[model samples]
Structure formats: structure tokens, C-alpha cells
Target chain A: MSDLSRLSLNQATIKYAGMEQAVSACLRAEIPGIGLWREPVAEYGLRKTGALLRQAGLTPTSMCRGGFFTSPDSDQRIKDLADNRAAVDECAELGVPELVLVSGGLPDGSRDVDGARSMVLDSLAELAPYAGERGVRLAIEPLHPMFCSDRCVVATLGQALDLASRFPAEQVGVVVDTYHIWWDPTVYQAIERAEGRISAFQVCDWITPLPAGVLLGRGMMGDGCIELRRMREAVDKAGYTGPIEVEIFNQEIWDADAMEIAELTAARYVEHVL
Target chain B: MSDLSRLSLNQATIKYAGMEQAVSACLRAEIPGIGLWREPVAEYGLRKTGALLRQAGLTPTSMCRGGFFTSPDSDQRIKDLADNRAAVDECAELGVPELVLVSGGLPDGSRDVDGARSMVLDSLAELAPYAGERGVRLAIEPLHPMFCSDRCVVATLGQALDLASRFPAEQVGVVVDTYHIWWDPTVYQAIERAEGRISAFQVCDWITPLPAGVLLGRGMMGDGCIELRRMREAVDKAGYTGPIEVEIFNQEIWDADAMEIAELTAARYVEHVL
Candidate 1:
């Protein structure tokens, strides 16, 4: 039998369920880990969510996300920095290992992507030290390029690593999610370069002939063509022994029974990834 | 009046029109440049199409495409390389400055994007010498990440440049199409780094609240929220003085009259960009 202990279920995999229900479902399935999002945590209250997960004997894998550093105005940027500091505080309070970050996209009313990226770096520099002191490692999640306009400025593993390399490894690192970066040519090299600084490793399949322009077309394991074993091998080779988080966002799966989705994800992790 | 001399029309913008019809429309409108595709040229016969464009004073800006380097087997890769060499010959014969390359996506039954990229690089190395001998520059077009699985492997401008930097500038360059790369955070810096290697600059708008699952949701010039003038300025600052090709692939624009679309594109370029 394969070891299924390394599997983690990101809450987004069954986001339709309330935070309490999700925690119960994870407990029911005996899934080893959970990745929490801010919205649900805020709704249920952080202390309650933390207590629920702890009661379920689940390790919090990583926080859902916390970066959007690009803005057209200086005041807006300062406000975003403040917001990120708050996210860091939340992650620390939740006792999560890392605070996942989706770097902000281009500033509104502007097309200078490079300029916006510099602003992201500046914001990260400001937030990393605060997050470091709080014992919450900043895990930069490089989203797919499709989200580069309105979602995240960090769009590749290499770019994320480049940004992370600027800070101390203990303060800033990267999250390797198969759904966001499986198509990137430099992903393997970037992962290798990331070494032990890979704070999180995520898995989800990419559905072919992508469903229109919806940015969130995440497929469940074995439903799409991602070679999970190979990606896991890459992470292992890079010395990352963190829990493998299942972070799917498929609408069909989300609409299904949350317990069923959580159970299926755990089974898929055992059957496909392990 | 703003100079219309710099405007070029990509055939895909009017995909509904026949090659002869597209050429006739360009001639009627007095547009100076035309980007041709192999399918239409093959359909109408190359000799006749070449003669028609030549007689109409249409300078072929760049060939439609010539790279699909990733495949599941060596035989398929060999076939792709041979086809690309033939495309290089066609571009040379047509006297175009560059042969646009959409480095093909993942090979079937393969999830190793790095391996697929190696295949692409190997194929380019095999084809570049031949392309260089024929005086045709291979322009690597960094398609949107949505196309990364089924369409093209090169998904970001930085990734494309990193690959291109492996070869001589004359042998490998890039096609900066706004539709494919407007969302990249490092797009401007990547373009600036590309500098003398920016062979072609293409334009298209991005529509938000995109339709479901169809990843190729291209917007027309003024229909979406892309900062066209800013993109133009970026390309200009990169020192590319080539034709500013309007290369929209929107269903709405394609369903319109070809002549009307061309006229509208020209008008938009003048009003928004000039």
C-alpha cells in the first residue's frame, strides 16, 4: 500500500462548503493536512477555524494567498503593504507554516508591466522582514500567465524564485503548484534552483482545450494530463519534504458533496501521486 | 493625417476571407504590409499568391508560423523540423524578414514540459542554421499560457528570450504580440532586454468577464481594456521600428466584413496609437 500521509487538501478544492463543514469533511476523511483561505477563516473567525483544524488532527499546509502589490497610486500601494502585514499576522496566529502570496498584477490604467513588477519587489521587501519576525514564511505562488492582467504579477516559477532569491531564504521562498506552472519550460530548473526554499508544493491537473477564458479551470488528479509523479519527483529532488497539497478549483467538483470531493482527492493522491 | 504607412494586417484577423480576397482588400485599402499563412498560400498556390502580393506592393511582414518543435517521438519531431525548413524556404522566397514560430506544446502522453522544451530547443538548433542560411530569422512568439498544453510551449516573453539568447540574434528572435503577452509582469523589461531581437510587434485587445473555457478569447482593438498606446510605446522604446501589425482573432471582428475590419483597425491605430 502507498503512503498517503503526505497529502493535503487545499480548502479551495471544496470551497463551496462552509469552513466548519470543510474541516469536518477533512476530519471524516482523516486527511493529514489543510490549506486555509482568508475569506472563510475571516467568516468563521480565525480562532475557531484553528481550533477546528487542530481538533481534526490536520496540519495547516499553507494559507491560501496574500499578495497584490501592484497599484496605480502610492497611497494604494502603502495600503496594500498594510494589508499584507495583516495577512502575515493572520498566518502566524493560525500557526500555518507559510503565508502563500499571489503577487499583484499590472497597476490599473497602466501597461508598464516591468514597472509594476518593481513595485511588487519593493512591497515584498517591506513585508518579508515583518513576516520573518512573525515566524510566517512568505511563500510566493507564481500563478499562470492567464491571471497576469488582473490577478498575480508573479507568473512563472523562475520569476518567483528570482524575487525570492533577493531576500533571506528563511524570510521569502516559493510555492510550486502544478496547475499554475506545469506548462512553463523553466519549471524544473526553477524548482531545482529553489532548493529547500520551496515552502509549499501543490497539485491539480490542467484540462485540455481550456474551458473558454475562465481563469480557474483546475482539474482533479487523473482527470487531466499532468504527470503528478514526475512533478513530485522534481519537488523531492529539490529537497522539499512538505505535504503535497491538492488545490483544485473545478466548478463541477466544487458543486459536488464536499465530503465526497475531499475523500476523492485523498484517494486520488494515494492512487496517482504516491 | 497620421501616417497609415506603418499599418499591417495579419490574415488571421480576417480568417473568414480567402487569401486572394485578403490581398485584394489590402491593396484596395493601400495598406503597406501583410502577414501570410501557409494554409491560404497552399490553398491558392504559392506562385500565384506571391505574384499577387508582389504586384500589389504588399511587403510580407512575417510568415504566419513555422515551429511546433515538441512531439512524442523523434519521427514526429523530424517531420516538424522538415516542415519548418520548408516554411523557412517559403518565407525566404516571399522575402519576408522573419518566420513567426509558435513552438509547439507538450507531446502526447508526456507531462515533462522541461523535456518538451529541450525538444523545442533541439529542433530550433537543427533548423536555425538552415533558416540562417536562407536569410530568414525565426521569431519565437510567446503565446498565452492558456495555449501551453495543446497549442505552444513558449508561454512567456522572458522564457522565450531565455531560449532565444541561446542562439545568435539573427538565428532566433521574438514576436511580441499584445494579445498573447500583455499580461506578463516583466513584459516591458523582457522587451527591453530583447532590444535588437524584437522582430515583430503585434496588437490585440483583452476582453474581461471572458466566455467559459474557450481560452482563445481575443478582443478587437477598441473593444477591450488593453493599453494599446502604452504597448506601442514599449515596443518603440525597445528600438523596433517595424510595422505595427493588427493581429486580432476575435469571433466578432472575424464575422464582420473584411474591408470594414481593416478600415476599423487602421482608424483605431491612428486614433489610439499615433
Candidate 2:
């Protein structure tokens, strides 16, 4: 069997599950790691959630997010920075070393993508030091280009690596989520270039006929045409010995039982992504 | 008034119009050129369509497409090649110098994108010589990465240029469509590198919350956030003094009056893309 110890169930994959339930599901499936999200940790109370994971012997793989620093509103921008710092503090409390950063999209009524990108970099310069001081690495996640307008402007692995390379590798890293970067022709080369900067290696499949909002269309492992095992192997070759988190966001997957989803995900990971 | 002499109205912008009607509409709107599609040319009878275009003093800017060589079935591959050759023949008959090529997506149940990409190259090697002999330049159009799986595997201008460089620039070139490539970080640089091999320059806008199938979601020139003028300037700076074809694919656009649509497109081309 593939190493179950290295498998992580990102809470988003089982969207309906509470933080407590997600930890229990991971425990029941013998999944040694659980990737936490900021909202759920806050909902369950950070200390209680951290204690729950500790009690279950489950490692907190990484925190879900902490970026969105491209708001056009000055007040919102300040709020976003403050929120990100809080995320870093949460990571410290949860003992999670990595915090995924989703750089926000272009500002409302604005076509200046370069400006938005610069804002992300500027925010990172401020936050990276804070995150590093708390032993939390900021993992810049290059979301799919389709999400460039409203979700995240960092659209390619190369761009993410270029930004991450600007900071110390430990302070600023990248999340290689296959759903977003699999379409990139230079992805393998980018992976090779991202040696020590790879903070989290997330896997999900890419099935098309993308649904309306295009947000909840990710396929389950082996349910789509992504060469999952190949991507995992590339990250491994890049010297990343980190947890491989399954992070699907489909509505159908969310409606299912959390433990069943976790068990099936583990099985699929072994079958198709080992 | 911005230059109208170099404008071409691709029939897709007025999707409901028949070939003859599209030609007449372009002529009425004083649109000097048009980009033809194979199906409509075949429907109107290729020779008749060619005669009609010549009679109306309308130039055939480029042929719509001729690729899709990534099918897994051997018979389908043979058929695709044969169809592409016929498209080349049609281009020759119509006196169109360029044929836009959209390389097919992955074969069903296949996860090897590299293998699929190689198939496109091999097919190009075979077809390039045939197209060259007929004086028809094969313009490889790298679609948006969202279409990388189901529609076309060539998903970036750089990748298209890489493939185009392998063949004689006269025989193989690349299409710079703003809607498909605007998200790319290196698009302007790629356009400059395209220099002598830019066969066609197409424009459309990029609006979000893409409709089902995402095929007909392309916005009319000024309806979305793309820096249309900037992209056009980049193409011009790259030394391409050719027809600027407006190729939008949207349901509402298709349902509008073709002549009105053509007139508005011309106006928008001047206001936004010129």
C-alpha cells in the first residue's frame, strides 16, 4: 500500500464536516494528517481544535488560506492584512507550519492586473516577516487562470515561484495544486525550479464542462484525466517530502459522508497517485 | 476615425449568418476582409463562396481552423488528417493564405498530456509540407488553458510559437487572439517573439461567470476587461500589419442582426481595439 502516513484530507474536500468531525474522520480512516482551514479552526475555537488534533495524533498539514490582499478599497486592504496576520497567529497556535496564500483578483472596475500583483507582493513583504517569526511559511497558491478575475491573480506556477523566490524559501513558499497548474506547459520545469519552496502538494483532478461559477468543478482523484501520480512524482523529485493533500471542491463530493469520502480518497490516492 | 481598412469580421461574431449573408454583411458595413470557416464554406459551395468574396471585393483574411489530430483511434486520426488536408485545399481554393489550427485535446481516458502534445507536433510535421506547397500558412492558435483538455491542447502563445518555430515561418505561424492569451504573463513578450510569424490577429473580450460549455462566453470587444488596445498595439509593435479579425462567440451576439453586429464591432474595434 502507498504510505497512508503521508496522506492528508483537506477539510474542504469534505465541505459539510465540522472541524471536530473532520479530525475524527481522518482518525477513523487512519489518515495521519489533516489540512485545516482558517474558518473552521475559528469556528471550533483554535485552542479546542488544536487540542482535538493533538488528542487524535493527527498532524495539522497546513492552514487553508491567508492572502486576498488586492482589494481596491484602502480600508479593505488594511482589514485583509490584519486578517492575514491573524491567520499566521492561528497557524502558530495550531502548530501548522504553512499558510496557503490566495492572492486576490483584480479590484472592482479595475483592469490593472499588474497593480493587483504588486499589491500581493507588497503585502507579502509585510506578512512574510510576521509569518516567519511565528514559524509559519506563507504558501502562495497560484490558482487557475480562469479565477484570475475574481479569485486570484497569481495564475501560473512560474509566476508563483518568481514571487516566492523574492523571499527566503522558508518564509515564502508555494502550493502546487494540480487542478490549477496541470494545464501549464512548463509545470514540470516549474516544479523542478521550486525545490525547497514547495510548502504543500495538493492533488485534485481536472474534469471539464466547468460548472457555472467554475469554482466547484474539481474532480475526485482518478475521476478525471490528470496524471496525478506523475505530478506527485514530480513534486517528490523536486525534493518535497511533504503531505499530499486531496482537496476537491465539488458540491456532490461535499454532500457525501465525510468518513466515506476520506476513506475513498485514501484508496484512490493509493490506486492512482502512489 | 480609426483605420477600418484592415478590419475583418470573423463570421463567428455573427454566428447565425450564412456564408453569403456574412460576406454581404461585411461588404455593407464596409468591412474589407473576413475570416472563413470550413463548414460554412462547404455549405455554400467553396467555389461559389470564393467567387462571391472576390466579386464583393472582400478579402478572405484566414480560414477558421484545421487541426484536432490527437484522437486515440487510428481511423479517427486518419480522418482528422484527411479533413485537415481538405481544409488546406479549401484555403487554397478561396485564396486565403492562413488556416487557424486548434490542436485537439487529450484522447478519452488518457492522462498523458505530453503524449497528446507530441501527437499534435507529429501531425503538424505531416501537414505543414502539404499546406506549404499550396501556399497556405498553418496558423497554430493556442486556445485559453481552460480549453486545454476538451477543446485544444495548445494553450499558450509561447507553446504555439515553440511549435511554429520548428517549421518555416512562411508555412507555419501563430494566431494572437486577445481573449485566449490575455491572461498569460508573457503574452506581450511572446507576441514580440512571434515577430515575423504572426499569421492572424483576432480580438474578443473576456467576461466572467462563463456560461455552460464556456464555448459561447466570449464578449464583444468593449464588453469585458481586456486591455484590447494594448494587445493590438503589442501585435502592431511586433510588425504585423494585417487584418484585425473580431471573432467573438456569444449567444446574444449570435442572435443579433449580423449587419448591426458588424457595424457595432467596427465601431468598437476603433474605440477599443485600434
Candidate 3:
């Protein structure tokens, strides 16, 4: 059996709940790790949120996101870089292991995805050293292809590993989220390539006959069709002995009681995924 | 400028309209080509639909779909192969140049995408002779990765082309559709690789920040943010001189009058895409 204590709850799983409540619920459930987003951190004020997490004796696995590198203008790209630098600073303050980077989509009024990816690489290279100096690791999260146009340009595990390979291992890496990469044929091989550089391992399930819009149907663990045990085996083979973070973005789960959701997520991890 | 007479109206654009009405509207609009779906053809009676298209002087560009080879049982796989053979016969009877094939997603209760893909390739190899004998070319259409779990397993243009390269060009080829593949960084290179083997070329825009619960939000030529001109340039440079078929699956267009939608689609193709 896997270690249930390594389970981390991403706050977006219960985004309908306030940040303090989510932190408190994680403590109540004895979930050792938590992943946070900028909005909630800002809403609660970082210092207070950090103190509360410290009080709850929870370690932050990662800071939710940073990096929308593709933009129509150099000025916008520079602005994004500056914003990411600030995100890096925030990660350093939070003492998180990694800052999840979601490479932004096609630039406005631009149709060249290759060009947008080039911009992303250049921005990552520029941001890496600053982040490295601050002891903050950058974790590129390859979102599912559904978000290719508007959310993130990096859309597969192989693609993320390819990008990460371009930079030093300590400067850049990848987050293997089952929600985003469970469908990739090259996922296992990509995981093997990311062995030592595997920054985060996120878990979620994919539901069938996805409703008209593909974004809102992310299923919670055990609720959908993904074989969590198989994925865990792949991660284990890849030598990634890290926190198995549950980062579900389900509409139904978000509206339920925060504490209840956390406890149920913990129990589900123990019964199904672990 | 693109050849306006080479424009093909995929019937799914105005899905709410009956097959006969869509064909009549396209003929009236002086559109030279039409792509048919099996459901509408079966509903309207294939003979009636075929006779109407002939009577109206509209050329069938290609069949809308034919492959969903992944299944839980050997019986279903065999059945899928037989169904594909039938679809090939339909395409040949309709004088269509190619039958579009969408590799099916993961098998029922299975998450092995590689296994599903291997099943698709094996099914294709089995069906290729039947299709070739009927004078029907199989055009593999790679769907967006979002469909990898439920709809189609072929998720990238390069992946589709790579699969096609495994067989004889006369038996297997690729359908390069902008909406499904525009996000790929290697799309331009893939199109170049597909030079003489591109059986079909499709056009549709990719809209951003799509509404919730909608997976098939295909934008019209100028509606969404895809770089249609650049994509057309790549297709042209790659030595493809085929008709650019407009295949939008937008609810907004489907809800409109068939004739009006046809007219607007033609105008948009000329104004923005051509």
C-alpha cells in the first residue's frame, strides 16, 4: 500500500470554500500537504495564510501557478515575466518546493503556436536564474489539450519534458497531473525521462462522454474512470517518491462542505488511490 | 485568393437542418462540395440523399466519419471493422474521394491509450484492403487531445501522419483539419511531411475561453482566434491544392437558418480565410 500521509489537497478542489476554512479542514483531516493558488493567498493575505498553515503544521507542496508567457507584445511579455518573478518571490516566502508554471496559450491576434512556444521558452530561460537564485523551483504543468487555445500552450507530458530538457534540471521541471496527461500515449516514457526532475504528481480522474464543454467535467478520484493504481505504479517506476497531490476541479465537490470534502478526499485516497 | 468554387459545406455546420435542406441550401448558394454524416443520411434515407445531391449537382467532398475501432471486446472490434467496410462502400457509392476516420478513444473500462491506438492501427490494416478494393481512400482525422478519452485517440497531426506513414499512401492518408490540429507546434512541419498524402484539408477556427460544458465549440472562419491565413499558407506551401472544407460544429451556427448559415459561411471563407 502507498503512503496515505503523502496526500496533498489542492485548494481548488474546494474553491467554493474560503482559504482559512480549507487550511483548517486540511488540519482536521490530518492531510500533511496543501497546494495553494494566488487568489486565496492574496485574499487571506500571504503572511496570515502562511501563519495559519504553519499553525496547522501543513507543508505547502506547491504554489498553484505562474507563467502566461505568450502575449501579443513585448511589453505584455515583460509584464508577465515581472509577474512571474513576483510569483517566484512568493514561493520562496511560502517555502514551497515548486512554483507551478502554466505556459500561456496563443498570443492575441496570433495564430502561430510554434512562435508562442518560442516566447514561452525564452521567458522561462529568463525567469529560471532569478528563481534558481531564490531557491524556487519552476514546475511546468502540461494542461490537457482542451486548454490549448486559451489556458496553456504546453499540453502533454512529452511536450513538458521536452521543454524542461531545454533547461537545467534544477531550474525547470514538470508536474504530472493525471487530469492533464492521463490520455498521452507517451506518458509513461515521459515520466521516466522526468525521473529526478519530477516536481509534482497531481491526481484526478477523467469522466466519459464529456459534457459539451470539456473543462468542467474533471472527476474526483474514484468517481471517474481513471485507473489510479496503474498511474501510481508508473510514477513509482519513474522513481518519483513524492506527495501524490489530489487536484480535482469538480463543480459538485466544490459546492459541498469544505471539511467534509477534505475528509472524503482523504478517505478516497486511502481506499482507492493508496 | 482561394478558389471559391472549391468550397465544401460540411453538413454538420447547420446540424439542426435536415440533410436534404442543407444540401439544397448549399446547391442554391453555388457551393461546389458537401460532406455527409451517416446519421442524417440514414434518417433521410441514403438513396434519397444521394439522389438529391446528384440532382443538385453538388459533389460529395468526403464522408463525415467512419472509425471508432477501440472497444472492450473482440466482437465489438470485428463489428467496428465491418462497419468501416460499410462506410467505405457508402463513400465509393457516393463518389466521395475519401472516408474520414477518427481513431476511437480508450477501450471501455480501460485507460491504455497505447493499446487503444494499437487496436486502431490493427483495425485500419484490416480495413485498408476492403477500402482500397472499393476505391475509397481512408483519411485519418486526428481529433483534439480532449477527445482522447471519449471520442478519438489520434490527438495530433504528427501522430496521425505518423500512423498513416505506416501504410501505403494509396491505402491510408491524413485529413488536416485546422480546429483539431491548429494548436500543435509541429503542425506546419507535419503538413509539409503530408505533402502528397494529405487526402483532405479542413478549415475551422479555435475560439478561446469557450463556454462551460461545451467541448465542440468550433468557430467559423473569422469568428474564433485561429490564424486561418497562416494555416492556409502552410497547406499551400506543402503542395496541397485541395478544396478547403468548412466544418464548424458551433451551436450558434446550427441554430441559424440553413440557407443563411451557408451564405454567411461562404462569405466568411472568402473574406477572412480565402
So what's the TM-score on candidate 1? 0.87
Report how far off residue A250 is in candidate 3 (Å): 1.6
Q: True interface contacts reproduced by each model, as a fraction?
A: 0.62, 0.49, 0.50
Tens-digit per-residue lDDT, B31-61, candidate 2 = 9999888888888998999889989999999
* Best prediction by DockQ: 2
- lDDT of each residue in A1-274, candidate 2, tens digit only: 5679799999999989998889889988889999988888888899999889888999999998899989878898889999999999999988999999999988877778888889999999999999999999999999988888888989999999999999999899999999999989999999999999999999999997898878998999998989999999999999999999999999999999999999999899999888
What is every candidate's alpha-carbon RMSD to the true fold?
Answer: 3.2, 1.1, 2.6
What lDDT tens digits, residue by residue, belong to model 1 across residues A59-157? 898997788888878888788888888889999998987999988876665556777788888888899999999999999998887777677878888
Measured against the native two-chain assembly using Cα atoms, what DockQ does each of the candidate structures obtain, in the order listed? 0.49, 0.71, 0.46
> Candidate 3 residues A1-274, lDDT tens each?
4456788999989898888788888888878999999888988898988898887889889888998998878787788899999999888888887999999987666667777788888988999989988988899999887788777889888888888888888889899898888766567778778887888988888886565446667887887667787888788888888888888876778888999989888988887678
Clashes of each: 5, 0, 6
Query: Backbone clash tally for model 2?
Result: 0
What interface RMSD does candidate 2 have?
A: 0.9
Across residues B87-165, which tens digit of lDDT does each residue of candidate 3 receive?
A: 8888887788889998887766776777888888898899887888888889999988777777888888888888888
lDDT of 3 at B135: 82
Question: lDDT, candidate 2, residue B262?
Answer: 91
Error of 2 at A54 (Å): 1.0
User: How well docked is model 3, in DockQ terms?
Assistant: 0.46
Model 2 residue pairs with clashes? none
